[model samples]
Target: MTTAAGRTLHAGALLPELIAVRGIAAVAIVCAHALSMATRGHGGVPPSVEYARLIVDFFFIQSGFVLAHVYDRTWREGRFHYLTFLGKRLARLWPLHVVTLLVVAALVLAGRAAGLETENPHTLWSFAVTFLMLHSTWATSDLAWNWPSWSVSAEWCAYLAIPLFFLAADRVRGSAARIAVGLGLFVACAAFSELVLGADIVTLTYDGGAFRIIPSFFAGMLLRRMFDDEPALVAMSPRGYAATVGGVLAACAALIAMNATYDALWPLMVVLTAALASRAAQPKPGLLRGRALAWLGELSYAIYMTHAIVLQVTFTSAKLLGIGHTFPQRAALGFAALIATAVVAQAAYTLVEKPGRSLMARLLSQPRPARAFAAAADRTGAGR
Candidate 1:
């Protein structure tokens, strides 16, 4: 059930499990995109090429749950100053985002300079939306910039909403209300997907439908609330805990069997992520541990931001060079490009991503806003 920390345990210690999972999930995401690239110019809807994106779905849900797992630690010492929270997120995201954007822009400009002929229509408008992170809506359309960006926007929104979600849960009378609110958010996301992305129940696509992703964040928020409330349920024996985790795995397999697929499967991914997080957070690690996973987690931001650009550049350059005969051959070349990209991504994380983020924080985080809950820690500290 519960651990020495009083928080319910799930699987083999929480922190290591989560860190391991994040790394695995990142690899899965890479695999999914690789599968997508093996096909024609674009990828969507085909059991093999299409369904791989479920990995990214897992990634999103993981984002929410991990955020919740760490939220208590941060807020325990301070109030929720909106500015600080937003600033920290910027510090986390903006550096990679801006640098990757500019680099992509530079490449595209370079291609244009070489008369490679690409597109950047609605230049001012697209640039503004991207700068503001409103580019998330592109998930609902044929447009995507630096392509993988949609998830970053969604992750940002989820972080901004987590505090409010926690506040809502703190004020709610029971788990039912909090869960209902989480479900309501899911329903809203579905409705948004239906209306904006126009995804019919009959059609399945890898479309970046924004509505489909909300369930991940909602699931995370719900789990955060549940963590605060369910110490008894969490304190089960190790065998029982293993069964519970097995059930979650079985449920995920069942979803695949049901052919729910991608947009249709977001809700399940949300639930899965929550369970995984609850289990993973059980065994918190000491500082400076899990160096490799932590490094991946850190470079994760850069990898995500730059991978799309890398893929596009690789593909377009290959096309321009008239390289490769068969899809399989090009696929091999693509793998090489991905490896090169990983190296570049790491460098970008260090040289550009980290620095750019720091610079933005310096710019956006000054003149700290005044708020009651903005203290460094919670006034009424409640440990699990």
Candidate 2:
């Protein structure tokens, strides 16, 4: 099927393993949020929870790879319609964003009415920023409503720059050169962020977070380019693919064991994402390609967007019920919260996101009446 950007994307164009990874990333992020809540105002966050923030970088990289895989060809052929592209991206992201923002707002109002303190930003300016998807820009702090949507906000900025990024990538000539340059750029950007900005890339907020996403996004494009140029890498045997995946998993285990910081593990993450993406292109039945993982992957975006809200509600309700202070109780409640998040995300995907996207696509694809009339007039004049 061709996307609104006029890019042809076959069903197989989507790599199942990548989808599975998305599911995993979504879960990690949710766990991280839940853990943070459980440990609120407490020091010593578990290393696993702390490192889970790198999943956002993985998200950026994956997005870049997927977008390039689907749209780069059309872009190179000069068929990419920027407005249509932006509309499609907005359609995909905005509906759930608005819904979650409203949910958070209502929760805040209820808390206030009950004489409870809510962490949500209740000001008009914050609402406007969240609605405009500008919450991650330098102009604002982290959004009070739908705090997790900060990544989505950062992604919006990347989506706006994708065309230009692709244009630059197109000029790099060879896939090897492009990949090399992309890695170099990533390192440079990481250094600048760490050294000059004096901010850990993983902990970046505001405009700093926006800067954090660019390198991974570009690296993802480079990975796609390399995959396209070198079929051998993706043509690995099933055993070889399994081994590569196993190695990546082992590395993740080791990182967790060592309690590596997000900064220490991000480069490894980029390499592993690239490697796994390459392996995913192979026609093999990997663990990540399992039905359960695939389902979670399909719902990953909804999960990412709604999980924080779900966590907050779950914890708040638990607190009201006096069920969360004890470790065992909190653990049980957290598990239940995860289940609830999945259920709610599934509903959002089926009822809101899918329909909203279809509607938006149809609306954006329709021709303007004035343009239609002008075209008809030109045709009539030609007939004369």
lDDT of 1 by residue, 1-384 (tens): 535456554322345555655665665566567556656643443564455566666776566665666565555557546667778787888777877777777876787789876553525566566666656555233343465675676666666666665665456546777677766766676676678767632122225434345665556656665766776445544555566667766776677677764455555665555555545544545332367767776666667667777777777777778875567766786787678767987999879877777888787756455544554335446431
Off by over 4 Å in 1: 1-14, 41-45, 71-78, 119-122, 138-142, 158-167, 195-197, 200-213, 232-250, 261-264, 284-291, 362-384
Clashes of 1: 21
For candidate 2, write residues 193-293 as lDDT tens digits.
77898877777756566788888888788777776666556655567666776787788778789876566666666677766776655554666778999
Global fold similarity of model 2 (TM-score): 0.90
Q: Evaluate residue 144 in candidate 2 and report its C-alpha lDDT on the 0 to 100 scale.
A: 75
- Separately for all candidates shown, the number of backbone clashes (residues 3 or more apart, or on different chains) is 21, 0
The TM-scores, one per candidate, come to: 0.77, 0.90
| Local distance difference test, each candidate | 0.62, 0.79
